[model samples]
Target: MENIVLRRVIPSDNSCLFNAVGYVMEHDKQKASELRQVIAAAVASDLEKYSEAFLGKPNEEYCAWILDSEKWGGAIELSILADYYSREIGAYDIQTTRCDLYGQVTPMEGAPEEFDQTIFPVLQDRTIGTVIEGCALKLVEEAQRKRSYTDTANFTLRCGVCQTGLKGQKEAVEHARATGHVNFQEYS
Candidate 1:
Protein backbone atom coordinates (compact mmCIF):
# COMPACT_ATOMS: atom_id res chain seq x y z
CA MET A 1 0.00 0.00 0.00
CA GLU A 2 1.27 3.46 -0.78
CA ASN A 3 1.57 6.18 1.81
CA ILE A 4 -1.50 8.43 2.26
CA VAL A 5 -1.31 12.21 2.57
CA LEU A 6 -3.55 13.70 5.27
CA ARG A 7 -3.78 17.35 6.20
CA ARG A 8 -6.00 20.17 7.47
CA VAL A 9 -8.57 22.01 5.32
CA ILE A 10 -8.06 25.62 4.18
CA PRO A 11 -10.35 28.51 3.21
CA SER A 12 -9.22 28.26 -0.42
CA ASP A 13 -10.63 24.73 -0.59
CA ASN A 14 -14.31 25.73 -0.41
CA SER A 15 -15.30 24.94 -4.00
CA CYS A 16 -13.29 21.73 -4.14
CA LEU A 17 -14.57 20.70 -0.76
CA PHE A 18 -18.16 21.07 -1.92
CA ASN A 19 -17.24 19.11 -5.01
CA ALA A 20 -16.16 16.20 -2.88
CA VAL A 21 -19.43 16.43 -1.02
CA GLY A 22 -21.34 16.40 -4.28
CA TYR A 23 -19.43 13.31 -5.30
CA VAL A 24 -20.56 11.49 -2.17
CA MET A 25 -24.16 12.66 -2.56
CA GLU A 26 -24.47 10.80 -5.85
CA HIS A 27 -25.19 7.66 -3.83
CA ASP A 28 -28.22 8.89 -1.90
CA LYS A 29 -30.59 11.85 -2.13
CA GLN A 30 -32.26 12.57 1.21
CA LYS A 31 -29.17 11.66 3.22
CA ALA A 32 -27.01 13.85 1.03
CA SER A 33 -29.21 16.88 1.53
CA GLU A 34 -29.16 16.43 5.28
CA LEU A 35 -25.39 16.23 5.33
CA ARG A 36 -24.89 19.28 3.11
CA GLN A 37 -27.12 21.39 5.33
CA VAL A 38 -25.28 20.25 8.41
CA ILE A 39 -21.89 21.09 7.01
CA ALA A 40 -22.99 24.39 5.47
CA ALA A 41 -24.46 25.55 8.76
CA ALA A 42 -21.35 24.54 10.65
CA VAL A 43 -19.20 26.42 8.18
CA ALA A 44 -21.40 29.48 8.23
CA SER A 45 -22.19 29.82 11.95
CA ASP A 46 -18.69 29.98 13.42
CA LEU A 47 -16.10 29.39 10.72
CA GLU A 48 -13.40 30.64 13.03
CA LYS A 49 -14.22 27.89 15.51
CA TYR A 50 -13.90 25.22 12.82
CA SER A 51 -10.69 26.74 11.50
CA GLU A 52 -9.11 26.81 14.91
CA ALA A 53 -10.30 23.35 15.93
CA PHE A 54 -9.64 21.64 12.62
CA LEU A 55 -6.83 23.71 11.06
CA GLY A 56 -4.91 25.36 13.88
CA LYS A 57 -4.68 22.09 15.82
CA PRO A 58 -1.91 19.59 15.23
CA ASN A 59 -2.23 16.40 13.17
CA GLU A 60 -3.81 13.52 15.12
CA GLU A 61 -4.56 16.12 17.74
CA TYR A 62 -7.67 18.17 16.93
CA CYS A 63 -7.64 18.70 13.17
CA ALA A 64 -9.53 16.76 10.49
CA TRP A 65 -7.76 14.86 7.69
CA ILE A 66 -7.99 14.52 3.92
CA LEU A 67 -6.57 11.09 3.05
CA ASP A 68 -4.91 10.89 -0.38
CA SER A 69 -2.86 8.17 -2.00
CA GLU A 70 0.63 8.91 -3.20
CA LYS A 71 -0.35 7.98 -6.76
CA TRP A 72 -4.08 7.39 -7.26
CA GLY A 73 -7.08 8.01 -4.97
CA GLY A 74 -8.34 11.47 -3.96
CA ALA A 75 -8.76 13.02 -0.51
CA ILE A 76 -11.75 12.82 1.87
CA GLU A 77 -12.59 14.85 4.96
CA LEU A 78 -12.64 12.89 8.21
CA SER A 79 -13.09 13.47 11.97
CA ILE A 80 -15.71 16.21 11.55
CA LEU A 81 -16.52 16.67 15.25
CA ALA A 82 -17.00 20.24 16.43
CA ASP A 83 -18.70 22.04 19.31
CA TYR A 84 -21.67 22.83 17.05
CA TYR A 85 -22.31 19.34 15.56
CA SER A 86 -25.61 18.65 17.23
CA ARG A 87 -28.63 16.77 15.86
CA GLU A 88 -30.89 19.66 16.89
CA ILE A 89 -28.79 22.12 14.92
CA GLY A 90 -30.96 24.42 12.82
CA ALA A 91 -30.16 24.68 9.09
CA TYR A 92 -31.80 24.30 5.74
CA ASP A 93 -31.14 20.78 4.56
CA ILE A 94 -30.95 21.06 0.77
CA GLN A 95 -32.71 18.51 -1.39
CA THR A 96 -31.06 16.18 -3.92
CA THR A 97 -33.03 17.76 -6.73
CA ARG A 98 -31.67 21.12 -5.72
CA CYS A 99 -28.18 19.69 -5.53
CA ASP A 100 -28.38 18.20 -9.02
CA LEU A 101 -30.06 21.24 -10.45
CA TYR A 102 -27.43 23.47 -8.93
CA GLY A 103 -24.70 21.58 -10.83
CA GLN A 104 -23.41 19.75 -7.79
CA VAL A 105 -23.14 16.54 -9.76
CA THR A 106 -20.68 13.71 -9.63
CA PRO A 107 -16.96 13.98 -10.53
CA MET A 108 -17.18 17.31 -8.74
CA GLU A 109 -17.82 20.39 -10.84
CA GLY A 110 -15.28 23.24 -10.71
CA ALA A 111 -12.56 20.67 -9.93
CA PRO A 112 -9.30 20.10 -11.78
CA GLU A 113 -8.88 17.41 -14.43
CA GLU A 114 -6.03 15.66 -12.64
CA PHE A 115 -6.78 13.39 -9.73
CA ASP A 116 -4.54 15.34 -7.41
CA GLN A 117 -6.08 18.59 -8.55
CA THR A 118 -9.66 17.45 -7.93
CA ILE A 119 -11.11 17.60 -4.44
CA PHE A 120 -11.34 13.85 -3.96
CA PRO A 121 -9.04 12.52 -6.64
CA VAL A 122 -10.22 12.67 -10.25
CA LEU A 123 -10.52 8.89 -10.12
CA GLN A 124 -12.75 7.45 -7.44
CA ASP A 125 -11.21 4.32 -5.91
CA ARG A 126 -12.02 3.91 -2.25
CA THR A 127 -15.58 3.93 -0.93
CA ILE A 128 -16.85 6.87 1.13
CA GLY A 129 -17.09 4.53 4.13
CA THR A 130 -13.35 3.97 4.15
CA VAL A 131 -12.78 7.68 4.23
CA ILE A 132 -15.08 7.91 7.26
CA GLU A 133 -13.04 5.32 9.11
CA GLY A 134 -9.95 7.42 8.75
CA CYS A 135 -11.95 10.35 10.08
CA ALA A 136 -13.23 8.48 13.14
CA LEU A 137 -9.75 7.34 14.04
CA LYS A 138 -8.52 10.91 13.86
CA LEU A 139 -11.35 12.06 16.11
CA VAL A 140 -10.68 9.33 18.65
CA GLU A 141 -7.03 10.25 18.69
CA GLU A 142 -7.80 13.91 19.25
CA ALA A 143 -10.34 13.18 21.98
CA GLN A 144 -7.82 11.02 23.75
CA ARG A 145 -5.30 13.82 23.67
CA LYS A 146 -7.77 16.47 24.81
CA ARG A 147 -9.03 14.44 27.76
CA SER A 148 -8.81 16.71 30.81
CA TYR A 149 -10.47 17.16 34.15
CA THR A 150 -13.19 19.40 32.76
CA ASP A 151 -13.20 18.27 29.10
CA THR A 152 -13.26 14.81 27.57
CA ALA A 153 -13.72 13.51 24.05
CA ASN A 154 -16.59 11.18 23.30
CA PHE A 155 -16.57 8.21 20.89
CA THR A 156 -20.30 8.10 20.39
CA LEU A 157 -20.58 7.14 16.74
CA ARG A 158 -22.50 3.92 16.15
CA CYS A 159 -23.28 2.18 12.92
CA GLY A 160 -26.60 3.60 11.75
CA VAL A 161 -27.76 0.15 10.65
CA CYS A 162 -26.04 -2.44 12.79
CA GLN A 163 -25.82 -0.21 15.81
CA THR A 164 -22.19 -1.15 16.16
CA GLY A 165 -19.44 1.43 16.41
CA LEU A 166 -18.99 2.99 12.98
CA LYS A 167 -15.59 4.00 11.72
CA GLY A 168 -16.61 6.88 9.45
CA GLN A 169 -19.37 9.04 7.97
CA LYS A 170 -19.90 6.88 4.89
CA GLU A 171 -20.43 3.84 7.01
CA ALA A 172 -22.90 5.64 9.19
CA VAL A 173 -24.98 6.60 6.17
CA GLU A 174 -24.63 3.28 4.42
CA HIS A 175 -25.90 1.60 7.54
CA ALA A 176 -28.66 4.04 8.28
CA ARG A 177 -30.83 2.71 11.09
CA ALA A 178 -31.22 3.06 14.82
CA THR A 179 -27.71 1.78 15.48
CA GLY A 180 -28.15 2.50 19.16
CA HIS A 181 -25.52 5.25 18.97
CA VAL A 182 -26.58 8.80 18.28
CA ASN A 183 -25.14 9.79 14.91
CA PHE A 184 -24.73 13.35 13.78
CA GLN A 185 -25.28 13.59 10.01
CA GLU A 186 -22.91 16.35 9.03
CA TYR A 187 -20.83 16.73 5.85
CA SER A 188 -21.99 13.97 3.54
Candidate 2:
Protein backbone atom coordinates (compact mmCIF):
# COMPACT_ATOMS: atom_id res chain seq x y z
CA MET A 1 0.00 0.00 0.00
CA GLU A 2 1.18 3.52 -0.73
CA ASN A 3 1.93 5.65 2.27
CA ILE A 4 -0.95 8.00 2.98
CA VAL A 5 -0.45 11.11 5.03
CA LEU A 6 -3.21 13.30 6.45
CA ARG A 7 -3.28 16.63 8.23
CA ARG A 8 -5.42 17.41 11.24
CA VAL A 9 -7.47 20.58 11.77
CA ILE A 10 -8.20 21.24 15.39
CA PRO A 11 -11.46 22.93 16.28
CA SER A 12 -11.12 26.33 17.90
CA ASP A 13 -14.85 26.75 18.42
CA ASN A 14 -18.27 25.28 17.72
CA SER A 15 -17.93 25.93 13.97
CA CYS A 16 -15.53 23.05 13.62
CA LEU A 17 -17.52 21.37 10.87
CA PHE A 18 -17.67 24.54 8.81
CA ASN A 19 -14.03 25.08 9.53
CA ALA A 20 -13.26 21.57 8.35
CA VAL A 21 -15.11 22.12 5.11
CA GLY A 22 -13.32 25.41 4.62
CA TYR A 23 -10.05 23.75 5.33
CA VAL A 24 -10.73 21.10 2.73
CA MET A 25 -11.55 23.81 0.21
CA GLU A 26 -8.98 26.48 1.01
CA HIS A 27 -6.69 24.91 3.60
CA ASP A 28 -7.57 27.74 5.96
CA LYS A 29 -9.85 27.60 8.99
CA GLN A 30 -10.58 31.35 8.86
CA LYS A 31 -12.62 30.83 5.69
CA ALA A 32 -15.19 28.79 7.63
CA SER A 33 -17.43 31.84 8.04
CA GLU A 34 -17.64 32.18 4.30
CA LEU A 35 -18.40 28.48 3.92
CA ARG A 36 -21.13 28.84 6.53
CA GLN A 37 -22.76 31.60 4.47
CA VAL A 38 -22.55 29.51 1.33
CA ILE A 39 -24.12 26.50 3.05
CA ALA A 40 -26.90 28.58 4.57
CA ALA A 41 -27.69 30.06 1.17
CA ALA A 42 -27.70 26.67 -0.48
CA VAL A 43 -29.95 25.22 2.20
CA ALA A 44 -32.27 28.22 1.94
CA SER A 45 -32.49 27.97 -1.84
CA ASP A 46 -33.74 24.37 -1.74
CA LEU A 47 -35.97 24.12 1.29
CA GLU A 48 -38.27 21.61 -0.37
CA LYS A 49 -35.39 19.26 -1.03
CA TYR A 50 -33.81 19.75 2.38
CA SER A 51 -36.99 19.28 4.34
CA GLU A 52 -37.58 19.02 8.06
CA ALA A 53 -36.89 15.30 7.92
CA PHE A 54 -33.31 15.93 6.91
CA LEU A 55 -32.83 19.03 9.05
CA GLY A 56 -34.71 17.82 12.14
CA LYS A 57 -36.50 21.20 12.06
CA PRO A 58 -38.28 23.43 9.58
CA ASN A 59 -35.99 24.31 6.69
CA GLU A 60 -36.04 28.01 7.50
CA GLU A 61 -35.33 27.39 11.16
CA TYR A 62 -32.53 25.01 10.31
CA CYS A 63 -31.02 27.50 7.93
CA ALA A 64 -31.08 30.16 10.62
CA TRP A 65 -29.51 27.81 13.11
CA ILE A 66 -26.79 26.79 10.64
CA LEU A 67 -25.99 30.41 9.98
CA ASP A 68 -25.39 30.89 13.68
CA SER A 69 -21.66 30.71 14.39
CA GLU A 70 -22.31 28.90 17.65
CA LYS A 71 -24.11 26.04 15.93
CA TRP A 72 -22.18 22.94 14.79
CA GLY A 73 -22.53 21.12 11.51
CA GLY A 74 -23.78 17.55 10.98
CA ALA A 75 -24.45 14.90 8.32
CA ILE A 76 -27.26 16.86 6.69
CA GLU A 77 -25.01 19.87 6.27
CA LEU A 78 -22.28 17.62 4.91
CA SER A 79 -24.65 16.28 2.28
CA ILE A 80 -25.67 19.79 1.34
CA LEU A 81 -22.07 20.91 1.11
CA ALA A 82 -21.21 17.96 -1.10
CA ASP A 83 -24.05 18.85 -3.43
CA TYR A 84 -23.20 22.54 -3.41
CA TYR A 85 -19.59 21.84 -4.26
CA SER A 86 -20.39 18.97 -6.62
CA ARG A 87 -17.77 16.78 -5.07
CA GLU A 88 -17.75 13.45 -3.27
CA ILE A 89 -17.41 13.89 0.49
CA GLY A 90 -16.07 11.10 2.67
CA ALA A 91 -17.14 11.36 6.29
CA TYR A 92 -14.94 9.17 8.50
CA ASP A 93 -15.73 8.21 12.04
CA ILE A 94 -12.33 7.77 13.65
CA GLN A 95 -13.84 5.98 16.62
CA THR A 96 -15.60 3.37 14.55
CA THR A 97 -13.27 3.32 11.55
CA ARG A 98 -16.29 3.77 9.35
CA CYS A 99 -16.54 5.99 6.28
CA ASP A 100 -19.68 7.07 4.49
CA LEU A 101 -19.93 8.84 1.15
CA TYR A 102 -22.16 11.82 0.53
CA GLY A 103 -23.24 13.54 -2.69
CA GLN A 104 -22.69 10.53 -4.92
CA VAL A 105 -26.19 9.17 -4.69
CA THR A 106 -27.53 10.99 -7.77
CA PRO A 107 -25.79 12.41 -10.78
CA MET A 108 -25.01 16.11 -10.41
CA GLU A 109 -25.48 18.54 -13.24
CA GLY A 110 -22.52 20.63 -14.36
CA ALA A 111 -20.22 18.87 -11.98
CA PRO A 112 -16.52 18.90 -12.69
CA GLU A 113 -15.43 16.23 -15.10
CA GLU A 114 -12.70 14.92 -12.88
CA PHE A 115 -13.46 12.78 -9.86
CA ASP A 116 -12.66 14.62 -6.65
CA GLN A 117 -12.70 13.44 -3.06
CA THR A 118 -12.76 15.34 0.23
CA ILE A 119 -12.51 13.81 3.66
CA PHE A 120 -13.92 15.11 6.93
CA PRO A 121 -13.74 13.67 10.41
CA VAL A 122 -16.98 12.61 12.11
CA LEU A 123 -16.77 12.92 15.86
CA GLN A 124 -17.96 10.28 18.28
CA ASP A 125 -21.07 12.33 18.99
CA ARG A 126 -21.98 12.09 15.26
CA THR A 127 -21.26 15.75 14.61
CA ILE A 128 -19.10 16.85 11.74
CA GLY A 129 -15.88 17.07 13.69
CA THR A 130 -12.61 17.84 11.93
CA VAL A 131 -11.23 18.14 8.43
CA ILE A 132 -8.65 15.77 7.01
CA GLU A 133 -8.08 15.66 3.31
CA GLY A 134 -5.40 14.39 0.93
CA CYS A 135 -5.15 10.64 1.22
CA ALA A 136 -6.98 10.54 4.54
CA LEU A 137 -9.06 7.52 3.64
CA LYS A 138 -5.99 5.64 2.57
CA LEU A 139 -4.38 6.51 5.88
CA VAL A 140 -7.42 5.23 7.72
CA GLU A 141 -7.40 2.02 5.77
CA GLU A 142 -3.74 1.54 6.47
CA ALA A 143 -4.26 2.17 10.16
CA GLN A 144 -7.05 -0.36 10.21
CA ARG A 145 -4.85 -2.89 8.46
CA LYS A 146 -2.16 -2.37 11.05
CA ARG A 147 -4.63 -2.44 13.92
CA SER A 148 -3.25 0.98 14.95
CA TYR A 149 -6.36 3.08 14.47
CA THR A 150 -7.21 4.95 17.63
CA ASP A 151 -10.32 6.93 18.35
CA THR A 152 -9.59 10.59 18.92
CA ALA A 153 -12.71 10.94 21.06
CA ASN A 154 -11.03 9.03 23.86
CA PHE A 155 -7.98 11.27 23.82
CA THR A 156 -7.20 13.43 26.85
CA LEU A 157 -6.09 17.02 26.82
CA ARG A 158 -3.12 18.15 28.86
CA CYS A 159 -2.41 21.76 29.67
CA GLY A 160 1.02 22.75 28.49
CA VAL A 161 1.52 25.32 31.21
CA CYS A 162 0.24 23.55 34.31
CA GLN A 163 0.15 19.93 33.14
CA THR A 164 -3.53 19.75 34.06
CA GLY A 165 -5.38 17.07 32.17
CA LEU A 166 -8.98 17.12 30.94
CA LYS A 167 -11.14 14.44 29.35
CA GLY A 168 -12.57 16.41 26.46
CA GLN A 169 -12.24 19.51 24.30
CA LYS A 170 -15.02 21.39 26.09
CA GLU A 171 -13.41 20.94 29.45
CA ALA A 172 -9.97 21.72 28.06
CA VAL A 173 -11.16 24.96 26.47
CA GLU A 174 -12.93 25.97 29.65
CA HIS A 175 -9.83 25.19 31.66
CA ALA A 176 -7.72 27.27 29.34
CA ARG A 177 -10.08 30.22 29.51
CA ALA A 178 -10.59 30.09 33.25
CA THR A 179 -6.92 29.71 34.07
CA GLY A 180 -5.60 31.68 31.11
CA HIS A 181 -3.52 28.72 30.03
CA VAL A 182 -3.39 28.93 26.28
CA ASN A 183 -1.43 25.83 25.37
CA PHE A 184 -2.79 22.28 25.38
CA GLN A 185 -1.90 18.96 23.76
CA GLU A 186 -3.98 15.84 23.23
CA TYR A 187 -2.82 12.53 24.67
CA SER A 188 -4.37 9.12 24.30
Candidate 3:
Protein backbone atom coordinates (compact mmCIF):
# COMPACT_ATOMS: atom_id res chain seq x y z
CA MET A 1 0.00 0.00 0.00
CA GLU A 2 1.18 3.51 -0.70
CA ASN A 3 1.83 5.73 2.30
CA ILE A 4 0.07 9.08 2.44
CA VAL A 5 1.32 12.26 4.09
CA LEU A 6 -0.58 13.92 6.93
CA ARG A 7 0.23 17.50 7.70
CA ARG A 8 -1.24 20.63 9.25
CA VAL A 9 -3.55 22.53 6.88
CA ILE A 10 -1.50 25.31 5.30
CA PRO A 11 -2.13 28.33 3.10
CA SER A 12 -0.74 26.64 0.00
CA ASP A 13 -3.15 23.79 0.60
CA ASN A 14 -6.28 25.88 0.11
CA SER A 15 -7.04 25.08 -3.52
CA CYS A 16 -5.76 21.51 -3.35
CA LEU A 17 -7.88 20.62 -0.34
CA PHE A 18 -10.93 22.26 -1.82
CA ASN A 19 -10.47 20.47 -5.12
CA ALA A 20 -9.90 17.14 -3.44
CA VAL A 21 -13.16 17.52 -1.59
CA GLY A 22 -14.74 18.42 -4.88
CA TYR A 23 -13.25 15.31 -6.45
CA VAL A 24 -14.62 13.09 -3.71
CA MET A 25 -18.00 14.70 -3.85
CA GLU A 26 -17.94 14.65 -7.63
CA HIS A 27 -18.54 10.93 -7.84
CA ASP A 28 -22.19 11.90 -7.84
CA LYS A 29 -21.41 13.23 -11.36
CA GLN A 30 -23.66 16.19 -10.92
CA LYS A 31 -22.45 19.76 -11.28
CA ALA A 32 -19.22 19.05 -9.48
CA SER A 33 -17.44 21.74 -11.43
CA GLU A 34 -19.64 24.45 -9.96
CA LEU A 35 -19.66 22.84 -6.56
CA ARG A 36 -15.88 22.85 -6.65
CA GLN A 37 -15.91 26.58 -7.17
CA VAL A 38 -18.19 27.09 -4.18
CA ILE A 39 -15.98 24.88 -2.01
CA ALA A 40 -12.90 26.77 -3.15
CA ALA A 41 -14.44 30.09 -2.21
CA ALA A 42 -15.48 28.83 1.22
CA VAL A 43 -12.03 27.42 1.94
CA ALA A 44 -10.33 30.55 0.75
CA SER A 45 -12.56 32.61 2.97
CA ASP A 46 -11.72 30.45 5.96
CA LEU A 47 -8.03 30.82 5.22
CA GLU A 48 -8.36 34.59 5.08
CA LYS A 49 -10.16 34.65 8.40
CA TYR A 50 -8.21 32.10 10.38
CA SER A 51 -4.84 31.60 8.72
CA GLU A 52 -2.91 33.53 11.37
CA ALA A 53 -4.66 31.95 14.31
CA PHE A 54 -4.05 28.57 12.71
CA LEU A 55 -0.30 29.16 12.78
CA GLY A 56 -0.09 31.01 16.14
CA LYS A 57 0.14 29.59 19.65
CA PRO A 58 -3.47 30.28 20.76
CA ASN A 59 -4.28 27.82 18.00
CA GLU A 60 -7.87 29.13 17.86
CA GLU A 61 -8.50 25.82 19.56
CA TYR A 62 -9.12 24.67 15.98
CA CYS A 63 -6.93 22.61 13.67
CA ALA A 64 -7.35 20.82 10.34
CA TRP A 65 -5.17 18.02 8.99
CA ILE A 66 -4.84 17.29 5.30
CA LEU A 67 -4.21 13.77 4.11
CA ASP A 68 -1.01 13.77 2.07
CA SER A 69 -2.67 12.52 -1.06
CA GLU A 70 -0.44 14.36 -3.57
CA LYS A 71 -3.37 16.69 -3.44
CA TRP A 72 -5.59 16.65 -0.34
CA GLY A 73 -7.44 13.40 0.08
CA GLY A 74 -8.85 13.59 3.58
CA ALA A 75 -9.13 16.26 6.25
CA ILE A 76 -10.44 16.66 9.77
CA GLU A 77 -11.04 19.70 11.90
CA LEU A 78 -11.18 19.95 15.70
CA SER A 79 -12.28 23.00 17.64
CA ILE A 80 -12.39 23.85 21.32
CA LEU A 81 -15.25 26.18 22.11
CA ALA A 82 -14.69 28.33 25.19
CA ASP A 83 -17.88 30.32 25.77
CA TYR A 84 -20.38 28.64 23.57
CA TYR A 85 -24.06 29.43 24.04
CA SER A 86 -27.07 28.41 22.06
CA ARG A 87 -30.55 29.53 23.05
CA GLU A 88 -32.71 27.70 20.55
CA ILE A 89 -30.79 24.57 21.41
CA GLY A 90 -30.75 25.70 25.04
CA ALA A 91 -27.05 25.31 26.01
CA TYR A 92 -24.51 27.51 27.67
CA ASP A 93 -21.11 27.85 29.37
CA ILE A 94 -19.44 24.93 27.66
CA GLN A 95 -15.80 24.29 27.04
CA THR A 96 -15.74 21.57 24.48
CA THR A 97 -14.01 21.10 21.19
CA ARG A 98 -16.28 20.05 18.36
CA CYS A 99 -15.13 17.38 15.94
CA ASP A 100 -15.88 19.66 13.09
CA LEU A 101 -15.13 17.40 10.14
CA TYR A 102 -13.87 13.89 9.47
CA GLY A 103 -12.75 13.59 5.90
CA GLN A 104 -13.05 10.52 3.65
CA VAL A 105 -12.35 7.34 5.58
CA THR A 106 -8.75 6.22 5.92
CA PRO A 107 -8.01 2.81 7.34
CA MET A 108 -5.16 3.17 9.83
CA GLU A 109 -4.94 -0.18 11.58
CA GLY A 110 -3.19 -2.02 8.74
CA ALA A 111 -0.98 0.89 7.87
CA PRO A 112 2.76 0.38 8.17
CA GLU A 113 4.19 1.42 11.53
CA GLU A 114 6.76 3.48 9.69
CA PHE A 115 4.00 5.58 8.20
CA ASP A 116 2.28 5.92 11.54
CA GLN A 117 5.33 7.54 13.10
CA THR A 118 6.64 9.26 10.02
CA ILE A 119 3.58 10.52 8.18
CA PHE A 120 0.26 10.67 9.99
CA PRO A 121 -0.90 11.93 13.31
CA VAL A 122 -2.82 9.46 15.46
CA LEU A 123 -6.08 11.03 14.29
CA GLN A 124 -5.02 11.33 10.67
CA ASP A 125 -5.90 7.81 9.59
CA ARG A 126 -8.86 7.33 11.90
CA THR A 127 -11.93 6.10 10.06
CA ILE A 128 -14.92 8.40 10.17
CA GLY A 129 -16.53 5.90 12.52
CA THR A 130 -13.49 5.78 14.77
CA VAL A 131 -13.23 9.53 14.90
CA ILE A 132 -16.91 9.85 15.76
CA GLU A 133 -16.64 7.26 18.52
CA GLY A 134 -13.51 8.82 19.95
CA CYS A 135 -14.98 12.28 19.86
CA ALA A 136 -18.22 11.15 21.46
CA LEU A 137 -16.33 9.48 24.31
CA LYS A 138 -14.17 12.55 24.80
CA LEU A 139 -17.21 14.82 24.84
CA VAL A 140 -19.00 12.68 27.37
CA GLU A 141 -15.97 12.56 29.63
CA GLU A 142 -15.33 16.28 29.33
CA ALA A 143 -18.90 17.14 30.25
CA GLN A 144 -18.84 14.79 33.20
CA ARG A 145 -15.54 16.11 34.45
CA LYS A 146 -16.48 19.74 34.23
CA ARG A 147 -20.11 19.46 35.43
CA SER A 148 -20.50 23.07 34.36
CA TYR A 149 -21.17 21.84 30.86
CA THR A 150 -24.86 21.44 31.58
CA ASP A 151 -25.68 20.45 28.09
CA THR A 152 -25.53 17.69 25.54
CA ALA A 153 -23.18 16.97 22.68
CA ASN A 154 -24.42 15.94 19.29
CA PHE A 155 -22.35 14.63 16.39
CA THR A 156 -22.69 13.52 12.80
CA LEU A 157 -20.49 10.97 11.09
CA ARG A 158 -20.23 10.92 7.30
CA CYS A 159 -19.03 7.63 5.96
CA GLY A 160 -18.45 7.26 2.25
CA VAL A 161 -22.05 6.22 1.79
CA CYS A 162 -24.19 7.20 4.74
CA GLN A 163 -24.48 9.93 7.30
CA THR A 164 -25.38 8.83 10.78
CA GLY A 165 -26.15 10.40 14.11
CA LEU A 166 -24.17 9.66 17.26
CA LYS A 167 -24.85 10.76 20.79
CA GLY A 168 -22.84 10.58 23.97
CA GLN A 169 -24.83 7.58 25.11
CA LYS A 170 -24.91 5.57 21.90
CA GLU A 171 -21.29 4.89 21.09
CA ALA A 172 -21.46 1.20 20.30
CA VAL A 173 -24.81 1.66 18.61
CA GLU A 174 -23.14 3.76 15.96
CA HIS A 175 -20.23 1.38 15.30
CA ALA A 176 -22.47 -1.62 14.84
CA ARG A 177 -24.35 0.32 12.18
CA ALA A 178 -21.28 0.99 10.05
CA THR A 179 -21.96 -2.22 8.08
CA GLY A 180 -19.51 -1.58 5.28
CA HIS A 181 -15.99 -1.48 6.60
CA VAL A 182 -13.48 -1.00 3.82
CA ASN A 183 -10.11 -0.08 5.27
CA PHE A 184 -10.71 -0.86 8.94
CA GLN A 185 -12.13 -4.41 9.29
CA GLU A 186 -9.67 -5.96 6.84
CA TYR A 187 -6.65 -4.59 8.67
CA SER A 188 -7.99 -5.56 12.05
| Tens digit of per-residue lDDT, candidate 1, span 1-188 | 22222222222232334333333333222233344344445444555655645544434322122222111111112223222232111111121111101111123334332322112322265664355334434444453455411111222354444446644545554455434344342221
Clashes by residue pair, model 3: 5-68
Best by lDDT: 2
lDDT of 2 by residue, 32-79 (tens): 678778888888888788788977899889878788886667787788
Q: Candidate 2: which stretches are off by over 4 Å?
A: 1-3, 101-138, 141-188
Q: Name the candidate that leads on TM-score.
A: 2
Q: Provide the TM-score for each candidate, comma-separated.
A: 0.18, 0.54, 0.21
Model 1 lDDT, full chain set? 0.32
Whichever of 1 and 2 has more TM-score, that candidate is: 2
Can you tell me which runs of candidate 1 are displaced by over 4 Å? Answer: 1-29, 52-78, 81-188
Question: Which candidate would rank higher by lDDT, 1 or 3?
Answer: 3
